[model samples]
Target: MLLKYKYKLKPHKSQSVIISNWLEIARKQYNYRLAERLNWFEATRTPVNACPLNVSVVPVEGIYQNIPEFR
Candidate 1:
Protein backbone atom coordinates (compact mmCIF):
# COMPACT_ATOMS: atom_id res chain seq x y z
CA MET A 1 0.00 0.00 0.00
CA LEU A 2 1.02 3.58 -0.59
CA LEU A 3 0.96 6.19 2.16
CA LYS A 4 0.58 9.89 1.53
CA TYR A 5 0.75 13.00 3.67
CA LYS A 6 1.10 16.73 3.39
CA TYR A 7 2.23 19.62 5.57
CA LYS A 8 3.23 23.25 5.40
CA LEU A 9 6.71 24.55 6.14
CA LYS A 10 7.44 28.24 6.84
CA PRO A 11 11.21 28.30 6.87
CA HIS A 12 13.13 31.48 6.14
CA LYS A 13 16.01 31.67 3.67
CA SER A 14 18.75 30.94 6.22
CA GLN A 15 16.76 28.14 7.81
CA SER A 16 16.17 26.65 4.38
CA VAL A 17 19.89 26.70 3.68
CA ILE A 18 20.57 24.92 6.95
CA ILE A 19 17.95 22.31 6.19
CA SER A 20 19.44 21.64 2.77
CA ASN A 21 22.90 21.26 4.25
CA TRP A 22 21.62 18.84 6.86
CA LEU A 23 19.90 16.71 4.22
CA GLU A 24 23.14 16.47 2.23
CA ILE A 25 25.04 15.46 5.37
CA ALA A 26 22.49 12.80 6.23
CA ARG A 27 22.63 11.37 2.72
CA LYS A 28 26.43 11.17 2.72
CA GLN A 29 26.49 9.57 6.14
CA TYR A 30 23.98 6.91 5.13
CA ASN A 31 25.91 6.09 1.94
CA TYR A 32 29.24 5.80 3.79
CA ARG A 33 27.70 3.61 6.48
CA LEU A 34 26.13 1.36 3.87
CA ALA A 35 29.41 0.95 2.01
CA GLU A 36 31.29 0.04 5.19
CA ARG A 37 28.62 -2.48 6.18
CA LEU A 38 28.65 -4.03 2.73
CA ASN A 39 32.45 -4.49 2.84
CA TRP A 40 32.22 -6.15 6.23
CA PHE A 41 29.46 -8.44 5.04
CA GLU A 42 31.53 -9.46 2.03
CA ALA A 43 34.60 -10.22 4.18
CA THR A 44 32.47 -12.47 6.38
CA ARG A 45 30.62 -13.99 3.40
CA THR A 46 27.31 -12.85 4.82
CA PRO A 47 24.01 -12.30 3.06
CA VAL A 48 23.37 -8.93 1.46
CA ASN A 49 19.82 -8.90 2.82
CA ALA A 50 21.15 -8.42 6.36
CA CYS A 51 21.74 -4.74 5.77
CA PRO A 52 19.41 -2.47 7.79
CA LEU A 53 21.22 0.81 7.34
CA ASN A 54 18.81 1.79 4.56
CA VAL A 55 15.79 0.59 6.53
CA SER A 56 13.10 2.68 8.16
CA VAL A 57 13.55 4.85 11.21
CA VAL A 58 10.57 3.73 13.25
CA PRO A 59 12.09 4.74 16.58
CA VAL A 60 13.35 8.10 15.39
CA GLU A 61 12.77 10.96 17.81
CA GLY A 62 12.45 14.63 16.90
CA ILE A 63 15.24 15.97 14.69
CA TYR A 64 15.00 19.44 16.20
CA GLN A 65 15.20 18.44 19.83
CA ASN A 66 17.79 21.08 20.64
CA ILE A 67 15.39 23.89 19.77
CA PRO A 68 13.97 25.64 22.81
CA GLU A 69 10.40 24.91 23.76
CA PHE A 70 7.87 27.49 22.66
CA ARG A 71 6.03 29.35 25.37
Candidate 2:
Protein backbone atom coordinates (compact mmCIF):
# COMPACT_ATOMS: atom_id res chain seq x y z
CA MET A 1 0.00 0.00 0.00
CA LEU A 2 1.17 3.48 -0.78
CA LEU A 3 -0.05 6.80 0.57
CA LYS A 4 0.91 9.91 -1.33
CA TYR A 5 0.84 13.36 0.06
CA LYS A 6 2.91 16.50 -0.32
CA TYR A 7 2.47 19.19 2.29
CA LYS A 8 4.65 21.12 4.68
CA LEU A 9 3.67 22.93 7.84
CA LYS A 10 6.35 24.52 9.99
CA PRO A 11 4.63 26.09 12.97
CA HIS A 12 6.62 27.28 15.93
CA LYS A 13 5.50 26.75 19.53
CA SER A 14 3.98 30.21 19.80
CA GLN A 15 2.12 29.81 16.55
CA SER A 16 0.67 26.49 17.68
CA VAL A 17 -0.51 27.98 20.95
CA ILE A 18 -2.06 30.95 19.18
CA ILE A 19 -3.92 28.68 16.78
CA SER A 20 -5.18 26.49 19.63
CA ASN A 21 -6.40 29.49 21.57
CA TRP A 22 -8.18 30.90 18.53
CA LEU A 23 -10.00 27.62 17.92
CA GLU A 24 -11.13 27.36 21.52
CA ILE A 25 -12.32 30.93 21.51
CA ALA A 26 -14.22 30.43 18.28
CA ARG A 27 -15.96 27.32 19.60
CA LYS A 28 -17.00 29.02 22.80
CA GLN A 29 -18.24 32.10 20.98
CA TYR A 30 -20.24 29.98 18.57
CA ASN A 31 -21.94 28.13 21.42
CA TYR A 32 -22.64 31.36 23.25
CA ARG A 33 -24.22 32.95 20.18
CA LEU A 34 -26.34 29.90 19.65
CA ALA A 35 -27.60 30.16 23.22
CA GLU A 36 -28.41 33.79 22.67
CA ARG A 37 -30.46 32.99 19.60
CA LEU A 38 -32.38 30.33 21.47
CA ASN A 39 -33.07 32.77 24.28
CA TRP A 40 -34.38 35.35 21.79
CA PHE A 41 -36.67 32.75 20.25
CA GLU A 42 -38.08 31.76 23.62
CA ALA A 43 -38.71 35.34 24.66
CA THR A 44 -39.89 36.83 21.38
CA ARG A 45 -41.26 33.77 19.54
CA THR A 46 -38.80 34.36 16.71
CA PRO A 47 -36.92 31.34 15.42
CA VAL A 48 -33.20 31.25 15.90
CA ASN A 49 -31.29 32.27 12.77
CA ALA A 50 -34.24 34.24 11.56
CA CYS A 51 -32.34 37.51 11.67
CA PRO A 52 -29.02 38.50 10.07
CA LEU A 53 -27.34 39.05 13.38
CA ASN A 54 -28.43 35.66 14.65
CA VAL A 55 -26.74 33.44 12.11
CA SER A 56 -26.95 30.35 14.30
CA VAL A 57 -27.30 26.74 13.33
CA VAL A 58 -27.57 23.97 15.84
CA PRO A 59 -24.48 21.78 15.49
CA VAL A 60 -25.24 19.05 13.02
CA GLU A 61 -25.04 15.68 14.77
CA GLY A 62 -21.72 13.80 14.86
CA ILE A 63 -19.61 16.73 13.67
CA TYR A 64 -16.26 17.31 15.42
CA GLN A 65 -16.75 14.21 17.55
CA ASN A 66 -13.11 14.16 18.71
CA ILE A 67 -12.31 17.68 19.81
CA PRO A 68 -8.73 18.09 21.04
CA GLU A 69 -9.76 19.36 24.48
CA PHE A 70 -11.67 16.13 25.11
CA ARG A 71 -8.40 14.24 24.91
Candidate 3:
Protein backbone atom coordinates (compact mmCIF):
# COMPACT_ATOMS: atom_id res chain seq x y z
CA MET A 1 0.00 0.00 0.00
CA LEU A 2 1.07 3.60 -0.66
CA LEU A 3 0.18 6.82 1.10
CA LYS A 4 0.12 10.24 -0.55
CA TYR A 5 0.19 13.69 0.99
CA LYS A 6 -0.60 17.19 -0.26
CA TYR A 7 0.49 20.51 1.24
CA LYS A 8 -0.65 24.06 0.61
CA LEU A 9 1.94 26.67 -0.31
CA LYS A 10 2.00 30.29 0.83
CA PRO A 11 4.64 32.44 -0.85
CA HIS A 12 5.63 36.12 -0.94
CA LYS A 13 4.83 38.17 -4.05
CA SER A 14 8.22 37.66 -5.74
CA GLN A 15 8.28 34.00 -4.89
CA SER A 16 4.76 33.61 -6.21
CA VAL A 17 5.74 35.19 -9.52
CA ILE A 18 8.80 32.94 -9.82
CA ILE A 19 6.77 29.87 -9.05
CA SER A 20 4.20 30.88 -11.67
CA ASN A 21 6.89 31.29 -14.27
CA TRP A 22 8.32 27.85 -13.46
CA LEU A 23 4.89 26.29 -13.78
CA GLU A 24 4.37 27.94 -17.17
CA ILE A 25 7.71 26.61 -18.41
CA ALA A 26 6.80 23.14 -17.18
CA ARG A 27 3.43 23.28 -18.91
CA LYS A 28 5.00 24.29 -22.22
CA GLN A 29 7.60 21.51 -21.94
CA TYR A 30 4.85 18.98 -21.22
CA ASN A 31 2.82 20.14 -24.23
CA TYR A 32 5.84 19.96 -26.56
CA ARG A 33 6.75 16.44 -25.40
CA LEU A 34 3.14 15.28 -25.76
CA ALA A 35 2.92 16.61 -29.31
CA GLU A 36 6.21 15.05 -30.28
CA ARG A 37 5.13 11.67 -28.92
CA LEU A 38 1.78 11.91 -30.74
CA ASN A 39 3.43 12.88 -34.01
CA TRP A 40 5.89 9.99 -33.75
CA PHE A 41 3.02 7.57 -33.05
CA GLU A 42 0.98 8.83 -35.99
CA ALA A 43 3.95 8.71 -38.37
CA THR A 44 4.80 5.12 -37.43
CA ARG A 45 1.23 3.78 -37.69
CA THR A 46 -0.24 2.28 -40.89
CA PRO A 47 -3.94 2.21 -41.79
CA VAL A 48 -5.59 -1.18 -41.36
CA ASN A 49 -7.46 -0.96 -44.72
CA ALA A 50 -4.84 0.65 -46.90
CA CYS A 51 -5.04 -0.66 -50.45
CA PRO A 52 -2.15 -2.35 -52.31
CA LEU A 53 -0.32 -2.35 -48.97
CA ASN A 54 1.05 1.07 -49.83
CA VAL A 55 3.35 1.24 -46.80
CA SER A 56 5.36 -1.65 -48.15
CA VAL A 57 7.25 -2.16 -51.45
CA VAL A 58 10.02 0.30 -50.65
CA PRO A 59 13.18 0.78 -52.65
CA VAL A 60 16.56 -0.30 -51.27
CA GLU A 61 17.56 3.29 -50.54
CA GLY A 62 14.20 4.40 -49.07
CA ILE A 63 13.78 5.72 -45.54
CA TYR A 64 12.10 2.46 -44.45
CA GLN A 65 15.09 0.40 -45.47
CA ASN A 66 16.95 -1.60 -42.80
CA ILE A 67 19.45 1.04 -41.75
CA PRO A 68 21.50 0.68 -38.57
CA GLU A 69 21.13 4.38 -37.68
CA PHE A 70 17.31 4.15 -37.75
CA ARG A 71 17.29 1.81 -34.80
The candidate that wins on TM-score is: 3
Report clash pairs, candidate 3.
Answer: none
Poorly placed runs, candidate 3 (over 4 Å):
1-6, 48-71
Among residues 3 or more apart in sequence or in different chains, the pairs in candidate 1 whose N, CA or C atoms overlap within 3 Å are none
TM-score against truth, every candidate: 0.53, 0.47, 0.57
State the C-alpha lDDT per candidate: 0.80, 0.78, 0.81
The candidate with the higher TM-score, 1 or 2, is: 1
- State the lDDT of candidate 2 residue by residue for 1-71, as single tens digits: 99999998788999999989999999999999999988976766555666654444545554666655543
How close is each model in CA RMSD to the real structure? 13.8, 16.9, 6.8
* Tens-place lDDT digits, model 1, residues 2-69: 99999999999999999999999999999999999888766666366876565443435565566787
List where candidate 1 sits over 4 angstroms from the true fold: 1-6, 46-71
Q: Candidate 3, 17: how far from true, in Å? A: 0.3
Question: How far does residue 1 in candidate 2 sit from its true spot (Å)?
Answer: 28
Give the local distance difference test score of model 3.
0.81
Model 2 CA deviation exceeding 4 Å by range? 1-8, 46-71
- Ten consecutive residues with minimal summed lDDT in candidate 3? 51-60
